[model samples]
Target: MHITMHDIYKSFGTNRVLTGVNFDLQEGEIHALMGENGAGKSTLMNILIGLHQRDQGTIMIDDKETYFESPKEAEQRGIAFIHQELNVWSDMTVLDNLFIGKERTSNFGLLNMKEMKALATEQFRKLSVSIPLNQEAGKCSVGEKQMIEIAKALMTDAKVIVMDEPTAALTEREIRKLFEVIASLKKDGVSIVYISHRMEEIFEICDRITVMRDGKTVDTKAIPETNFDDVVKKMVGREITDRYPERTSNLGEIVLEVKNTSKKGQFKDVSFSLRAGEILGFSGLMGSGRTEIMRTVFGIDSLDKGEIWVHGKKVSIRNPEDAVKAGIGFVTEDRKDEGLVLDFSIRDNMVLTNLHSFAPKGLIKDKKEQEFVDVLIKRLQIKTQSSATLVRSLSGGNQQKVVIAKWIGIGLSVLILDEPTRGVDVGAKREIYQLMNELTERGVAIIMVSSELPEVLGMSDRILVVHEGHISGELSKQEATQENIMTLATGGQ
Candidate 1:
């Protein structure tokens, strides 16, 4: 299928999201969509797949003008969208999720369980996924859920597939398998609209690229004719020379320390120390217990046996309230589920953790709350019309900044950031890293858990590798390298 969108225009209330943008995709080719958050990349694709109605545009599929009334309508026409926010029904089994709307029947008005399992199994095998179809979808890790979504899309035999941040939660090995699958699909005459912030993956797989900025088409070029610097400049409308800023922070006395921490069915014998004015990075493969370890430290999960000390004094933390009282803030990996309240306004989400400051008289101060929110919106450069804007409407990058903003001015001494830059654009990522450096300079300790090896190596003053629920190795700033970190994460000698 060859898809072309020309002179597109879309708006939400007073916000003009897309204005006269143009894009095209060739059959059997991978096309990359590049833009900073809120630059209207997702909105354009959503318009194509019938998730949103375009105010004005011309959509031509196979040289015939077509506009789908709904996503199901689009899918029936062989176009499938695998969204960034997962749609797994937590209580349902994996097999059920794979065939939720398009279930196979046994001709007796009942589900054909055997046939469904066989089909799901074959799809998993194609993606090299090892998840059990009988297990509850909620029990799967983020990476496994990502693979499930991919497999579900493939089952449709889609002629055109839109993948949004498909590899954000996947490890290197899983990414390799997914890439191999993409190559096979391409040879079968499948057209893919790949949307990802990973520059390396885009350059490696995509045949052409279209970059957008401020709701307008900046430029389009063939992959062979463009370079990374050129694409970034087009995406952000400026030059970004340094991907990772230089670090100049000095470590101080230990502020948060965990000794022999153990959680049944998760990590065991985890020992670490985070000091003031330092960044400690956690590197590991999928399901390696890095997230679980941090969850326990933040009191979201129980620690079976361990000692958590704050400022050289042992403390008991049974829930998130206690962790907050102890001056620890956590930005969960699954931000949508755990970090912010999506339905609430940006001001409400920002002040959720800092209520103590706004409620000194046993009554919330609206003036104080608005003042604090305004400062953070400016400091973080969060693009929004007003603090009254719902967090759900903000871009992923701005939502992340709101998560980070919640911890600020809360008298926080230690901050735990998990997959901080998972789906943020390159420009927003640089802003986030700059924020981290500024926090450390202000004597706040940061513990970053990342799957991106370059981020771990570039931003960390010290690094720890996890393998099979254990601390496989630890390295200092001078000793860490991508090769050795992978070696330790894979349990090498």
Candidate 2:
């Protein structure tokens, strides 16, 4: 089922989202849609799947002009959308979640649970997924849920599947499994619209690439015809000469020290020291307890046993507020779910962490708040029309910037970032790396937890490998290598 969209235009109130966009997908081909966040990639897909109406455009499927009034209508036409945020009922069993809304019923209106479970098992077998049918959906891992989502699409006999950031939260092994499943689906003649910010994956799995920028179609090319540099230049409209900024070694006195930190089942005996103007990276595979250690240090989780000292003064942090007051800032990994208040405006999110500073008299000063937001917007290069725009309206990369900006507003001695560039494009990643360089230059210490090996190696002055709730090994920048990191992360010597 070939799909073609021509001269598509869409707008939200006064915001013109997509302007004269053109896209095409060939049958049985895994075509990639590449762009920076807010480049109208989602909007275009939404319009195609009948989630939004296009102001002007033509949609053709199999040589027939078609118009879908709703997502159900699109689904009936063999279109399925697997959202980045998996849509599943955590309280329901895996079988129930798979057959959700479309459950088979008897003549008396009773659910056919037996049929549903059998069908779900069949689909899982087809996808080579081993999730238990009776288990609660929430109990399954992120990778398992992703496989379930794909199996659900197959149950609908979907010919065209739209996957949004499918591998954002997946580990390297899980990603390889997903790629294998995708290969099988392609062989079965299913077309996939793959959207992701990772350039390496695009070259690996996609047959063709479509680049979008600022609500317009920039270029489309075969994967073999173009290189990563060429695709990045088209996406950001500028040549990113450096993937990571050069850092100067300017180590200062120890800023933070954690001795014998332990969290019963989460992590144990974690000891580390961080110095001013240094980037300390924590590397590990999924479920290696890297995030747990950071959470405990940030006061989000209680440490069973440990001693923490800030600038040689022992401090007790019982909560996030206490940590914040002690001059520590944390940018959480799940930015949308944990970092930002989506309903709030850019100004509100920017000043969320430092509200007390703007409201010393117990009432917010609107003028002072706007001035502060204006400066931050300029400083962080957050692309937005006005400070009044809701945070939900911004793109993923810009939203991440707002999260970082919120922490930056509150003066910090140490900063913690977890998967900081998870869903952002290459261009935004360079900007973030430069921001880190700037922060370290001011003598601020940074602790970063990243699953991406290259990012950890490129940005960290020191790397610590975690494995199953313990620090297995530590390496200097000169000594760290991918093989060594992986070996240590997998409980090697």
Candidate number with greatest TM-score: 1
Count steric clashes of candidate 1: 0
Which parts of model 1 are misplaced by more than 4 Å? none
Q: What lDDT would candidate 2 get against the real structure?
A: 0.88
**What TM-score against the true fold does each predicted structure earn?**
0.99, 0.93
Q: Which candidate ranks first by lDDT, i.e. highest?
A: 1
146-224 per-residue lDDT for model 1 (tens digits): 8889999999999999999999999988898999999999999999999899999999999999999999999888999
In TM-score terms, candidate 2 sits at 0.93
Write the residue-wise lDDT of candidate 2 on 25-109 in tens digits: 9999999998998899988998999999999999999989987888889998899998765677779888888888789987889
The models' CA-based lDDT, in order, is 0.93, 0.88
